[model samples]
Target: MGKSERNITNWKQYNQALVNRGSVTFWLDEAAVNAWHCTKHHGGRGRGFQFSDTAIETALMLKGIFKLSLRATEGFINSLFQLMKIPLIAPDYSCISKRAKRRCCLNKRNLFRFP
Candidate 1:
């Protein structure tokens, strides 16, 4: 036998499936969002951190997963927030870099957990 033949009978359904395949879904847990900003103050001379460690970790995780540069990672996170209609801001690239450098050792924790 040669190559098999296929028929397209449902054009609308086929088109919809194609579009759905390219669609992506993202959501932020309310608890995670609440923890995005650091609430505990370290009582330092200079200004304290605005974003929490979880936020920075999440940003760095995204950067690594997407293979994006620092600036691009910031932009990507900001865009995701905007798309989700969340009144939150992503950590700037500089902040990410600073925090990333400050980490002495990487902990054995799952960084990709959402819930």
Candidate 2:
């Protein structure tokens, strides 16, 4: 074997990291769900939302991380909540799409800001 291929570097650490990735303990905490409610306020009719901004952000993160479609992301989050036995409601795929669109539109306006 060539010198470059002769030795395995940090193979144990790499293996452990891979193992750790499968553990759901990281984002499955009750605090993660609770943080969503702390800032939620019902300002008026049609203004109150069932899911929190944090929940939406988390769903987006999961969608990108797992390469899921909007519908699939909804199902994925639902399953996670069920597994965790948390009494939280999951947002629908359409909700995700709407929020993502609004977020993109806002970001576009901010993209041209100089300061």
Candidate 3:
């Protein structure tokens, strides 16, 4: 095939997929909400925390989805918990930052990769 004649065979499908990318979605199920509670950090100097790894991880996921700062993520999560009537505590920005550093590095490609 000539250079000008060579093009993506599925260009229309690709365009549709690109347009659908804007409809981002995030969900926290009932089971997850029930499991979202503070757990004791073994061997840590301080007392047990009020937000478990699940909560932190969830907030991190939303942070990427919503393109929010750490503090904003915390607030957003807190609001969501309140709105859902889930009596769970939200992690502060500093707590999120510290825990996030210990948990994993930021890899936008891995988190935001489509399909």
* Ten-residue stretch with the least lDDT total in model 3: 106-115
- Order the candidate numbers by lDDT, best to worst: 1, 3, 2
Task: lDDT for model 1, please.
Answer: 0.83
Go through the candidates in order and give the clash count of each: 0, 0, 0
Q: Best TM-score goes to which candidate?
A: 1
Model 1, runs deviating above 4 Å: 1-23, 104-115
Give candidate 3's root-mean-square deviation (CA, Å).
6.2
Leading candidate by lDDT: 1
Candidate 3: the clashing residue pairs are none
Model 3 compared with the native: what TM-score? 0.65
Off by over 4 Å in 2: 1-26, 37-39, 42-45, 104-115
TM-score of 2: 0.63
Candidate 3: lDDT over CA atoms?
A: 0.77
Per-residue alpha-carbon lDDT of model 2 for 1-115, expressed as tens digits? 5567556689998899999989856456667878755366657677666666667777777777667888999888888778877877678889877866644322323421222
Lowest lDDT block of 10, candidate 1: 104-113
RMSDs, each prediction? 5.7, 5.4, 6.2
After TM-score superposition, the amount by which residue 57's alpha carbon in candidate 2 deviates from its true location, in angstroms, is 0.7
The order by descending TM-score is 1, 3, 2
